[model samples]
Target: MLDAHLTTQLKAYLEKVTQPIEIVASLDGSAKSAELNELLEEIAALSERISLVRRDDNERRPSFAINRVGSDVGVRFAGIPMGHEFTSLVLALLQVGGHPSKTAADVIEQVKNIEGDYHFETYFSLSCQNCPDVVQALNLMSVLNPNIQHVAIDGALYQDEVDARQVMSVPTVYLNGEVFGQGRMSLEQVLAKLDTGAGAREAEKLKNKEAFDMLVVGGGPAGSAAAIYAARKGIRTGVAAERFGGQVLDTMAIENFISIGYTEGPKLATALEQHVKDYDVDVMNLQRAERLLPAAESGGLIEVQLANGATLKSKTVILSTGARWRQMGVPGEDQYRNKGVAYCPHCDGPLFKGKRVAVIGGGNSGVEAAIDLAGITSHVTLIEFDSKLRADEVLQRKLHSLPNVDIIVSAQSTEVLGDGQKVNGLVYEDRVNGEVRRVELEGIFVQIGLLPNTEWLKGTLELSPRGEIVIDERGRTSLPGVFAAGDATTVPYKQIVIAMGAGSTAALSAFDHLMRLPVAAKPELVAA
Candidate 1:
């Protein structure tokens, strides 16, 4: 199944294996099974220490497991691990074969010490960008601890099972036959759920840390830039985030990042994180800031309290908390959420295969979603609140050419219709003639816009009427020694490049603010 170039790369990567490994296939007499066997044989042939064997024991056909010769490393794939999951398969091979993993030492120990048996099955779409993280993390855990076992299933190939479980989203994980989580999750997040004491331990660690010269309040592009610039100044810098990637994790296509002509959202987010780690930035993931306490007086430390009761202090703080997906507040929308309502086409589009669905919005996201869904779903009805579509002309032309797609401009989504189980239809109002209409469908995809993640800073910081943090050209907030940037701020045109530039400017401004503080107030005096 792999091409010559990919085969060469896979062979080179497999050389990291320091011990013998076995590939056990649990496949049926099917085309997919034959293809998987071919791929596995090709992989085994590339390395002398690797061997393949057929063992059709698992009920899931076309599946295979990577096991260390003398150990019970339980990492398996339920389909051809290609597409976005190719890296996951590669990592599983190396890790299972006794090759070292880059996971933190503490985290590795924690995984190895977990108490109970965990059999996790994750359903993922091949096109999903977020699935690989969850898959790779769980696979690594399964390899590290025999108590844990993981199977990454391709939802498109295993549609029957996916439907039986009512999995409407990608990366939907089921542990011991129960829903565990349903999105992009890091290793720490998974451990925090399984190991109840992990949060308390992390909170305690944060509370005991020395005050940072600059503390970034998010880990998106903006927050990463701020942390990097501050760390380069040879001062203590820290970053705390609810999730490292922020809204970018849900984003799929990113064509306008400058220099890099084309890239995916999760890929860019990963690159941003790795770049930040290359510096001295202290990155704390899965930390949600509950409140902010401004300095009591000039030259005092700013305190940021997290939801887990941990408090972090800093000389100067940069607020780049970023924004989140905006939802359509129409009636029944919340009731039908996840049952048939979704936000990402790349992640959830597979579940709606051959079914009728509706796309709500007329912007680029909505139009692009319609275009993508048309290829999977039976039909796509695009409803827009505005008089006309706001998408680019090229996209509009492509959307118009799709036979299964229909556009409804000047219509507003009013309600989501469901039978108390799943979405069966939708209600809309025709703006042109003041008429109400209902479309019979099984899904609704909302692609409206973004809301600033500045809700926590409502009363603490000066905010614009639209809820964005108010900042000057130098990225200073109303509070002294506090600065803001990114989509969360009042920066015109919320773009990634702009957010990064703003973050750098805010970090520089924060440094200047600290330098002007009283000599005793400085964490350590800079040469200036």
Candidate 2:
């Protein structure tokens, strides 16, 4: 049940409800049901226009549906919507109770205009920082279109269903009983998947837009910062990113963001996005840049081609397309991905509760993942390709103290073993003796490393051997009027604060480059 502070906040929020709402509970004689019932009772107590009803018709026990009294608009939760999902629950309650959503009007219209049946079920974990976005987006979709029905299910509570469905990732969505997606997705992303013409329409709209003074190629911390800084100079700034949050959406925790002592990846990404939006930045999310074409002559317009065939022109461009998690390229790893291969321990560890799992790394992330998994899983096998763990002494000590964790150094993952449906074990090689060993595990969490998202920039910009954008100290790339920053650049430290600073530096450098351009070349582009 919500505590006093949360109850007060919920009561205040519920005061905005303009229509009667119904909370129908599907419960059984179980401890979880009792807990859910108590939570529902407390929720109903906070609002005069809200009422609770007891029902057991749902196949998923301890579930509940929030419905508007006179409409088909409703959303369901199959477990206690707490932790990161608490915001999702609150938003669902308000949205179903006639409170308006802050989603863009065009997007809401697109959702309402959708014609087909979409029964979406999102499997989530409480500790997952990314699940709420997918859950909330689908919840809003269901609220907008009566044909769309969505239920957010907690994988930890619905273990049997997760196993049966072979779900090995958080926020894994199923639309009409088929896999829709398996990561953090915004409302626009969900709409793009549903409305077939959405991408074309978006591309057409983008094509007609005027050119930008500074265009950012990503929307992570670095790109957000660059967009904000560029827009603050009273110039036309736009950000075209595949996803607004970039790889940060997959990240879980952050303890070293300067002033902020503690924060989550999604939270920081959201804040960065909002801050960028506060300026005159045109944030074009879910846009993937496929190619970059520099200006034909000095001080001319630079063009960026998107995957959708729309070309974005700018006086200056900043490339901040961040990196993604490195995958174990061993055999069967790709075939069994999401069947058992995972990246984030905070997200998928719950799905393997009480099952033996393997952590394939010895770095800080791997050791930390093992330490985190040791608490939830029956046992954790930490496999390191290095001679010793590269984690901090504190983390290594904590990992060693765990009773259910085993550390194996100088071992290389060779293959992932599965029973055609789900992972059953793993095969590795001892680097010291060249002996092959197989460990039985239900899941494998790969914490190996990250690879720069510079594949698209190949043959377009000067890149390091490791695929990072080669940049000078001032954030200027090898190409004139083109800059780079963040994890995709040659920056030594790939931290949030460093990325932000580099972003600002890149923006400033781009502005300087613009000012120093031929005075005659600026008028035509600026006027258009």
Candidate 3:
């Protein structure tokens, strides 16, 4: 609801105005187009009135401006702009009605010359105060040029995707597919990126880079390390990832990883990604390699055919494709994932400190989580569908000794209970007695089994019986110039330090492979 004062002001303003007004009741239903239509109608009317009022006020110029450079300004809206930002919205609308400000005019001039379609996604929650200004700015830009496609995603409406993206704040702007800039950006800053035309084109060109010193597949720990090392060594390193950070970003916390004692998955991934950025490393975040063919023209260049119809050529390939956690396959599992339910205990356990929580599955991860949660929380219920805990006796003894921990044997989780916003508790049924009961708790942790993310590399690389990548002693794979490491590979002990060490090893080996090749290339490297 709007404040009474502003409502009164708006009502007064509306009563005096004869402009065609259409209120957007919700942030849905062709909002961009509708708002745009309304804005155009208002601007056109203002244009007509400007000539009549301009004779007396010579200093006051008319509103509205257009760019001749690219096509559009491309404003991406994220949330509903009401409340305090409403004023900002009105100002923006007024600016849109009048001539474009110097900054907006310059941006329009720059965007008019752009060749490709610029897709911008703005993420916002309803509670955000400054989001309306961003939405208005993007809408204005979209109206300025038809080439700009602005997408406003209401975080309140899509909480699941918000959580999945690990969006901690509102008004995050994504240019193209990568993060362009965060928070409220000045119109000039937005124009600078548009004028450069480098960031967006780099990813597209990477798809066609025929020859690289190092080709790092996947965007997990090992592959990132390998790519960073190779790039730092001045080797042309290209990383083809289905998604940047792979499975590592899905984790909530990584306590066991050495040096970085307690860090969120996305934070760690971001740190590594930042490191990769420090050098010239070509990272394809959302690109998937479809096939690996040995170079036909010699020089050890491996042609990596991508599913996106782009080919990546490299001298050495490092495969660090990691594994994923097995889901319970229960209904609402996907919807509730990362909301109230989670797969990685180490990442998200601290969120439930001093609260009662439940752990599903009695494997090593489950036992470890139960024991770990015991240190912070008061009560932890371990529900196992199997007859017994599959962890070692030492862990089992530790879990049994904890007074707050309860082990429910042969119990299966039927459904995750929550308010469709966040996890509040869970429901389980005893396999033996067939009795179902609801448990009230703060959160539920799922740690069933690990599933390798190697489906894409099935025919290309040799996989173990468990679906993990098969690697030699030095992280070398069955194929020449290809190596594997981390949890995705044959290395045992799926610990953070182990993965890190394995990644380091694969990186060094990949560097060695690249060094063994002919002419030296000092590739620029960046961490991803």
Best by lDDT: 2
The C-alpha stretches of model 3 lying farther than 4 A from their native spots are: 1-204, 295-300, 330-358, 363-381, 390-406, 412-445, 515-528
lDDT of 1 by residue, 310-398 (tens): 99999999999999878989899988888899999988998899999999988988999999999999999999999999999999999
Sort the predicted structures by TM-score, highest score first: 2, 1, 3
Report the Cα lDDT for candidate 3. 0.65
Residue 104, model 2: Cα distance from true site in angstroms: 0.5
Runs in model 2 deviating more than 4 A are: 297-299, 521-528
Q: Is 1 or 3 the stronger prediction by TM-score?
A: 1
What are the runs in model 1 whose C-alpha is more than 4 Å off?
A: 297-299, 521-528
Candidate 3 lowest-lDDT run of ten? 51-60
Candidates in order, TM-scores: namely 0.96, 0.97, 0.53
**Listing every candidate in turn, what is its Cα RMSD in Å to the true structure after a full C-alpha superposition?**
3.0, 2.6, 14.0
Candidate 2 lDDT (Cα, 0 to 1): 0.92
Model 2 Cα lDDT, one tens digit per residue, 1-528: 788899999999999999999999999999999999999999999899999999899999989999999899999999999999999999999999999999989889888999978899999999999899999999999998999999999999999998888899988999899999997888888888777798998899999999899999999989998998898899999999999888888888899989889988998888999999898788899899998988875237999999998999998999999899999899999988988999989998899999999999999999999999999999999999989899999999999999999899999899999999989999999999999999998999999888999898899889999999999998998888999999999999888899999999999999999898876645545655
